[model samples]
Target: MFEEWSDRRTLRVFDPPRPVWVDMAATGMAGGFTPANTVPLRVRTSGARLEQRMQGWQHAWLQVSDGRWVAVVSVRLSSANEQSHASIPLTVAAGAIRPAESVTKDEP
Candidate 1:
């Protein structure tokens, strides 16, 4: 799944261990700022894939840009099952600096 906010982009993917539904939610926090709304992520899979007797995992990537700042969040799920759920908490710094090397530039 992909999401685009005012100045951010987010991507999420799921790999389930069984043919069940999984839900995911995330919230953002900053000083003197309460958390925003919770976003629900839904995942579905086929039974054949679940019965294959193999390990499963899920991946999620989130990127946030607030004009002067950029942030990223990555999530990994292991052995996900029917009752699997993930809650992620995000913190935004008011005056943090990110190294230049950490920013990805367009490939030549």
Candidate 2:
């Protein structure tokens, strides 16, 4: 069973058949007025994966190594699919993960 906490806007997480692990990250954005272009030209998606060791979500312990990985972004398909790509770098220290800094931004 599951429960919804509207006040927190978060769902309760329960144990699944297997352990939940996060290895990659992705994002998407879509807007604009395009009557043509047939498909993409208005939407975009980007994703990237990390290498080396980063684990232990219990306390969020991550031991990442310095490396670089390729990241790719693609627009959702309609009639014509458009894609853009890029490479991202990972700067990690060999130790427990540190709390990420918070950023303030307006909603899209």
Candidate 3:
């Protein structure tokens, strides 16, 4: 569901279901080129902006806003509106949920 790469796009960092090795350097490192490399790479866990998109021999990488590179599969491109909505907590009165009986199979 990722759109084309663009600067100033707010992105959220998330840990994948499985471990994904990420590169710490933005350039001159071939560690991200191969997932089976003996070199020990770090996992992604920081939220940052989209700096650049890099194509690796085996995978695609995204240069984070902080100059660190991470697997594209590890982060999700977030829109400014989504970021703003995420900050506002949902109150119980917001109707995020309802009584179990209120949700019927036919209605849903």
Candidate 4:
């Protein structure tokens, strides 16, 4: 799925073990971002709301200026029944994503 945000673009990708409702090999990605257009990302969803998680694919961070934006995508394994599905969105706290800075010892 795709989200056309005013600033940045958001696209949800399901790296499922296998395919089902969505054709693993087929989706009209006309003028849109595809897996080939992917970039490295960090994800978390420990305390995310169901409502936010249910948006398939969307941008959960706007004012946030640190971590990779959250992408809420649905997931289902080929072995499991269709009823067994979930919305896994990358959850994160505000301003929590940043590179760790090392501290150097000086004359204290």
Tens digits of per-residue lDDT for model 4, 1-108: 234545543433333311112222222211334362363332122222122111122223343355355323232222122333343333333222222123221110
lDDT of 2: 0.25
At residue 4, candidate 3 shows an lDDT of 57
lDDT of 1 by residue, 13-72 (tens): 333211111222212221232233332233232111122121112233334443333223
Error of 1 at 18 (Å): 28
**lDDT (Cα) of model 1:** 0.26
RMSD for each model, in Å, please?
A: 15.3, 15.6, 19.5, 19.6
Q: Model 3, range 12-105, lDDT digits (tens) per residue?
A: 3332222222231342222235343653333222222232331111123445567654443222333323341111111111111212322222
By lDDT, the better pick of 2 and 4 is 4
The C-alpha lDDT values of all candidates are 0.26, 0.25, 0.28, 0.28
Q: Identify the runs in model 3 with alpha carbons over 4 angstroms from their true place.
A: 7-59, 74-108
* lDDT-superior candidate, 2 or 3: 3
Q: Please report how far candidate 3 places residue 1 from its true position, in Å.
A: 3.1
Q: Candidate 2's error at 86, in angstroms? A: 0.8
